[model samples]
Target: MVENSNLLAEQRRALILDEVRRRGGVRVNELTRRLNVSDMTVRRDLDALARQGVVEKVHGGAVPVMEASTHEPGFEAKSGLELTAKEDIAREAARLVAPGSAIALSGGTTTFALAQHLVGVEGLTVVTNSVRVADVFENAARGGSAASPAATVVLTGGVRTPSDALVGPIADRAIRSLHFDLLFLGCHGLSVEAGLSTPNLAEAETNRTFVASARRVVAVADHTKWGTVGLSTFARLSEVDTLVTDSGLPAEAREELAEHLRSVLVAGAEGPATSG
Candidate 1:
């Protein structure tokens, strides 16, 4: 009877996942009614799927994971998904920046979070393809923040992606003409095989140019991004100087990443731990 009950639960969760994929997103109440299960049970099922990284649990429901190679979610859609993890990563990545240095930031929620931390850093010059990231500094300056005067922000001009990233020939030329002390890149996916990837092909090209222009590269991503490959790959794992991720990543996975990456910083309550 126990085995039978477990089998039923598995089947039910599978159905829920299918429903989420079909609809793009589904509320808990709707899932409960469709599956004929109690709200508690549906919530538990959503939690399980979220743990597997196959779906993302939202306010009262879940949405399909953007695991498809070509899948791309807009900036706002991604902003609320990994708030804590992104903040942790941003804090750690910020430590790598120095005053009076030119750095490049790529588009993605994680990089956007990092931009906030950098607002107070004195004498910093930032070049980015992300309109959202550029806005962080621009807004700070307008707000009369004393530290804003120490920062210079440059927004690349080009076609924009769903993530509010400027990409294409214009962005590419601008990046190639300049040099950066470091680059903080955010990706849709990361893995030993695919490395850093994005759903947009033009963004991939622009990211490649960013990598080439920088003396060092730091990839900032939460654990959920692991094993998720996007349509286009920008840089190999070997190309990154450091990887900063949240503690939600499994131990085994961190071990594997440390083998390819020069350094892996796992951010947690205690602080970021380094492995390489």
Candidate 2:
């Protein structure tokens, strides 16, 4: 009886996920009605899906996780998600930067947040393929304090991706010619199996060049990125030196990542706590 009941529940959750993907989003009340399940049951299913990183929970409903192997969301669409977590992760990533080092930043909302924190760093040279990230520094340079030297910002020009990334041969050639002290990368998904992946093939190639040009690489992602897989894999987990993520990442996931990464920093209100 218990086995049959569990199987039935699994079937219901599968249907719920399908509905969310088909309709873009679904309300808890509607799910309960459609599934012929109680409100509490529907909520439980949503919670389970959320924990699996397959769905996002909204105010009174659930939505499909926007990231898929072939689907990439635009910068504006992604900027609104996990705002606090991104801020925390960015804060932690910024600490890895030194005053006089040259670094490369890939395009993503999390890296864009990291750019805001780096504007005031003295004697910094930033090479990026992200228009949004470059703009943050460009705007800051115009209004920066005279006491501090302005950071040099380099924008690698290429065809733009949905996430505002400049990718393709033009960007790749520029990155390959320059070497950076560090690379701060943001990805559509991170899993032990896929490592750092993106939905865009051109962006993946561009990111590969960025990784090759840097002495060290730090991946910046929120908890939601865990377990997600994209169409192309750029770097494996072992290729990255560190990972900076929010505290919301499950303990087991953190532990697994620690085994593969040199350092895993969990960002919090106080600061980032180091593991591995």
Candidate with best lDDT: 2
Cα RMSD, each candidate? 7.5, 7.4
Alpha-carbon error at 78 in model 1, in Å?
A: 0.4
Backbone clashes for every candidate come to 0, 0
The CA lDDT at 5 in model 2 is 30
What are the runs in model 2 whose C-alpha is more than 4 Å off?
1-68
**Relative to the unseen true structure, what is the C-alpha lDDT of residue 233 in candidate 1, on a scale of 0 to 100?**
97
Q: What would the TM-scores of all predictions be?
A: 0.80, 0.80
Q: How would you encode candidate 2's per-residue C-alpha lDDT over 1-276 as one tens digit per residue? A: 011233345445655665676588999988766666688988998997787567999999988876558988899988977788899999889999999999999999999999999988999999999999999998998897889778999999999999999999999999999999999999998899999999999999999999999999999988777777899999999999999998666566788999999999999665678988
Write one digit per residue (lDDT tens) for candidate 1, span 84-186: 7789899999999998999999999999999999988889999999999999988888886653574788899999899999999999999999999999999
How much does candidate 2 score in TM-score? 0.80
Among all windows of 10 consecutive residues in model 1, the one with the lowest summed lDDT is 1-10
User: Residue 23 in model 2: shift from native, Å?
Assistant: 22
